[model samples]
Target chain A: MFKVGITSLCLSVLLVTSINASTSGKLLLSGGVNQVEGSAGGGLTPWAFIGGYGTEDEIGANAFITNVKSSDYNMVSTGFVVGFYNRFEFSFAHQSFDTRDVGATLGLGQGYELKQNVFGAKVRLFGDGILEQGNLFPQISFGLQYKKHEQGRVVKSYGAKDDSGIDFYLNATKVILSESLLMNLTLRATKANQIGIMGFGGDRKNNYELMPEFSIGYLFTRKFIAGFEYRFKPNNLGVATEDDWLDVFGTYAFNKNFALTIAYAYLGNIVLKDKQSSLYTSLQVGF
Target chain B: MFKKYTVCLLLLISCASTDKLSTYHDFGEKKGIEKVVDDLFVYLLKDERTKESFQRLNLDKTKEGLSNFICVTLEGPCKYEGQSMKRAHKGQEITERQFYGMVENMQKAMNKNNIPQRAQNKLLGKLAAMHKDIIGN
Candidate 1:
């Protein structure tokens, strides 16, 4: 089912791009890069801006592949996102987590992989994050992500209550052109453990908890941006303590069609490992 | 050490005064504005995305009006005698893409004219306020 959905999504993007849409209007790097969950945003969190270079009269789409590797683990995420009329965005991402030596220590075998799929939808509520520099009002958006894990039985055995969950978030973003700064705040409510890669809920907590994510970026030039992101996570499982995520990242847009992002992320703890630091990199291509 | 601190303080004061210069001065005043306007016209005409809309207008008058408008926006001494944004774009049927395409041209022009990024942002901030009046009318 997931394969079919992804195939259709790719087909639709091709179908739409073959039409009369031309990409020549939006400012350089105004369209945010694809986030971890395929939403248009920073490395870790979604921002209010819809993905792509499409203005109000056009459709835009992006495809991205990202990899994060640490001493104990490796993760790969790839996805596509489409924006419609600058009002709505739909995205899909698939993540595969490889537990290297840690999996063997836990008796699961070396290179045990945990995979999950994320489907997201977002709507612009109001305001213009960019262009409206005359006011303090930020562009607001509401979004939701539904995640399903492939290792349902294994996660349940590890004290997770469910293998799937939903996350709802409200995002606010603003770009102060005069100061060359961009700020974003997102409040997400979810019951996912480790962003649903280890399944949803757990023996310790079954109720949804609200988490906050924030990012601040400075535009060094029209082509380059550097920023920091902090994402608070909920600790729901009794087996291991989950930790918040933080990253310092930089993005350089080669042009409207391609962008490269690299980040040094400190992922506090994932299951048995503590103090996991990783290098995260992503490449985005779009119209 | 005390003498060095005093000298540094004096230099800081002078730098503050330079920073206080208005965006118009940063733009190199009238000649700079004219150069930017001329380059802007060249880009708008050469670009396929914006050439059609610009081709229907009078090039010389449009250039003069844009220069005056930008001058006024940057708080220069010039007086603008052109039509209001709403009036000038009354039936142009400009889409959001076209509006941004023009902004792109202006940015390229400003870059070619050696305007500082901070000054360019101030100008863009002022002009962005006119977006509502110019788009989708």
Candidate 2:
């Protein structure tokens, strides 16, 4: 039932967003791609750009579906993003993570799935990465994400503090057009365990902690971009050691309305498993 | 966290590569710039992207002024001091889309003239910084 609703919603958005490219908005590549947390950015870091083509006057939107497969698990995410006047953004994502063999090892049945819903909002604060061109003022933004992780009992049994939480972040992005390079620095405060898949907080550390995320991208051409992202994670749970996340991704924008990305992700450790390297892919439609 | 800060500092330092534009003078000399100016005008006149903006302009005079302006901007021998972008674009509420259209046509012209991406981006960098002054209400 949930899948059907999301499918219809995605289809409706795709149908409605074929709107003409005649609006006053950014170019095809300016908006960036959707991150894991339903923000416009690289795979792991949320940059300062308000997602989509919306200018200071026009409204624009984007939708994304992502799949990630690792040695011990597989996950799928679907999200919708709305950019208002290129100044503020609202986004929603539903993520389902399947623990293939690992679930059975943890005394759960095989192929157990953990579900999460994330809602986020971001506001651009200052600077223009592109228009400023060579200047030093990077684009900056502030954002927050509320995450609800289902299966609270399962997480609490493992000594988690909460099943839901909010994440706050600030991102600074700069695009050096002459060299075709883009960079992002983000500071995030959170108490989530395994990015809220294993639930939020823990008995070991029940307070919010600060971590840094980094992303760097290079545009090989107007239509293609290659990038890397690293997200730092805090160790809070005695359930299993959590590792930092890293990914290298490449995106190709077919046009203003369609884009695709492929990536290699390293999650480090999870639930007695170590060094979980995986393949990640996402398909996005934006206008 | 300290490692992250160090890496960010390195990236910030690298962002100051603005001086790179001044070093590549051999790519387009005064003679080459004259031809580029001509080709740019031709492309603007014929290219579908920016042809609309060039329709009402005087091509010959535009060619001379643009050529001289670029020559001096690139530290070449020619001397051309045109009106500021705001003054020249006054009364015309040029959109950013139209500005980019013109830049794309110029890029095609530069590509055809074999002006390398480094030099091409250098030129576009200077022009892009004039976005606010050129695009107005």
Q: What DockQ, on C-alphas, does every prediction get?
A: 0.64, 0.37
- List the lowest-lDDT window of 10 residues for candidate 1 chain A: A1-10
Give the lowest summed-lDDT range of ten residues in model 1 chain B. B14-23
Candidate 2 regions exceeding 4 Å error are A1-24, B1-53, B104-115
Write the residue-wise lDDT of candidate 1 on B1-137 in tens digits. Answer: 99999999999988756643478898998789999999999999988778998898999999888888888887788889999999998988988888888888888999888898778877887788778888888
Clashing pairs in 1: none
- Give the 10-residue window scoring lowest on summed lDDT in candidate 2 chain B: B18-27
Candidate 2: pairs in clash: none
- State candidate 2's DockQ: 0.37
Docking class of 1: medium
